[model samples]
Target chain A: MSTPATPLTDEELVLERLVALLEHVAADVLEGPVTDTGPGSLRRLGLTSVKLLEFLVAIEDEFGHVWDDDVEESVIGSLDAMAAHISAAGVAPAPTKRD
Target chain B: MHVKGIESWDLAYDGRQALHRTEDGSELYYELRGAGGPVVTLVSTIYVVSTAWRNFTGNLAGDHRLLSYDLRNQGASDGRPAEFAQHTEDLKSLLDDLGIERTYLVGTSISTLICRDFANAHPERVAGLVLVGPPFSPRGSSRRRRIAKSWLAALDAGGPRALFDLIYPLVFGDKAIAEGGSGAYLALRERFLAINSAAQLRANLREALGAGDQVERLTSIEAPTLLLSGDDDFSTTESTLDATAEIMRNAAVEIIRECGHLPYFEQPEAFQDAVARFVASVEEGTFPAPWTAPATEGKDR
Candidate 1:
């Protein structure tokens, strides 16, 4: 019998979703695979100003999070930070339609 | 930044940069360079900031007093959106504050319309006009409308970067893009992203799209005018430039080959040469004398 897979925690799930969104939005300019979730990881993954803005928009669209004009950069400084910020803000993912 | 060694053109080189408060209280960011020769005021397109004319300013500043400014809603300037008339007034205020008696205006793209309106409004203040890639019709074509709509949609969806990607091809010619290659393109993209934001670009576009046909206004400009167009510029054709020149009292058309909407960037030397020649012709009184249309031509003969 095969061992059962460990279920992902809520934070892990958010991180996974954020990575996916970054990959989708940064396909063209990404330098390498996005494995790191530490601070400045977005910049490390080769997200420039343009791609960063697109990624922010994607995050808002996916998570229903509206960024304030004066939002702290540290909140968006890394994948993990963004995930934590999203969870901390109590932003629920937008409801998806059943196919 | 993917590219290295790209020199910074953001700062004023030997000149002074300042923000002038218009009568309406909007701050207009402007740069004044050089001094002795004729004043050549550089007007920017909605997409770019005053530094976009760095090449032009560098080339002409040695001989001419260069005045380059960011209109409201442009780079390093206030984000307040204003119409063409408001922009014209701001230009007047800037000139007054600088003690500029008159200037030869060099404007590109949507700003060309601003130049036309300014020349019409303050005919005495304009010594000559260099209208680059001017839109001939006030009422744009259906195709133009479709493009504008798509641009707005792109801006709404992904911000200024998305809008830049959409317009990059349309704005530059094949020669320019091919020559610049990927590195050059990336550098330009970085600069554009640094200067522009979605909300600001959206406001500027709205004002640009609402611009009226200034063809009638062209007739009122009596200053020596050069309607400059890039041969590869799809936005405005040579025929359109010729027709626009016909409407003015003293106007001529100059086409710079292998260039697109922005000639100074693509073919700087050629653009500089053309502008220099025009200015020389005007100063030397060698420019073509104003042509008078035959009275019978407009009437049903």
Candidate 2:
């Protein structure tokens, strides 16, 4: 008998979506394919200001979340951090299709 | 050129600032200052406001009627996602409402496109034209389009502060950045962030970026034109400005050294002097002379 696969939790879903969005928006800026999605991984991605903004916008579009002007730096330090912030804020994935 | 009998009316409107509602029901904030000379309407760029023209107004107001205003979707103006041609129409309505028959138009950056369209549409009403940092060159439009996309994305991501941080280096020259220092830069950033919301900027940028090619329309502008460019302007260079001026029947190039995209902000005195001299020349009917290469061009080298 085959074991059933476990469904992803809300936090896991957010992280999955975030990684996809980041990869799509930051493909040009990123040196290689993303191999890490752990905490503080974003800092190692070497994103310039323009690429960072693009990633932020993509996150907003994908997660239906708006970042506060004074949002803590740590909240965007990595894919895990962003997923955690979005989940804590009770944000859901937007129904709109990603470009 | 003699001052029209509109002096009394101009004086009454001088120092008067108010909102003028267009036929489309959008309210535009305009301020009239200085009187007794030809009206010089300062067209604000997508991000700039009337208040940002304080340097230009203070310098030229003594001899020029200065009219500065925020276009729709900018500053205190009300409207969003307006069509490109709507701004041209708004200019017409504003001039008509103010009873101004003819005027000199000074437009910077994206607003230069607006001024060009207005001049082409109403050549009789344009006494002179000053296009500063016009981004109309086909050679530069693609690069500008890419930068514009980055700006829009920045605004959507972190509002005006993010956008400012991204564009600060491109908008201001090296000299201005070095001289202004971090404190001044921070202060300017605060002021910019406080101006308009992200939604407003998005609307303006969409309309500006979606605008069609206006290169062919340059030949239609018959007013005595002065194409101003900052030496370090990345969006449009001095050679581009020279080429643009060559397309027009009556146009000249004036490059301000040590300045970037915004000469009026970075080098006000130089900007003012160039404009004043050009306006004076146009008034005296002494400009737009036939083009000629220097007789000693090869010998000088």
Best by lDDT: 2
Interface RMSD against the true structure, candidate 1: 11.2
User: After TM-score superposition, what is the CA distance of residue A61 in candidate 1 from its true location, in Å?
Assistant: 37
lDDT of candidate 1 over B1-301, digit per residue (tens): 1112122223222235588988777788888887568888999876657866775456677788888898887776784677757888888989999999899999898788789888988999998999887765534344444666788889999787678788888788777676554434544565575567676788888877776664578887888998887778878887877777777788987777777888776666566666776777788888855422223321111
- Residues B206-290, candidate 2: write the lDDT tens digits: 8888766656788878899888888888888778878888788788887777778988776666777777777788888888674
Model 1 RMSD to the real structure? 12.4
lDDT tens digits by residue: candidate 2, A43-66 = 666453335555665676777777
* DockQ per candidate, 2 decimals: 0.03, 0.01
lDDT for residue B245 in candidate 1, whole number 0-100: 73
Pairs with backbone N, CA or C atoms under 3 Å apart (clashes), candidate 1: B138-B213
Instruction: Tell me chain A's TM-score in each of the predictions.
Output: 0.81, 0.88
Worst window of 10 by summed lDDT in candidate 2 chain A: A46-55
True contacts kept of each: 0.00, 0.00
The per-prediction CA RMSD against the true structure, in angstroms, equals: 12.4, 16.2
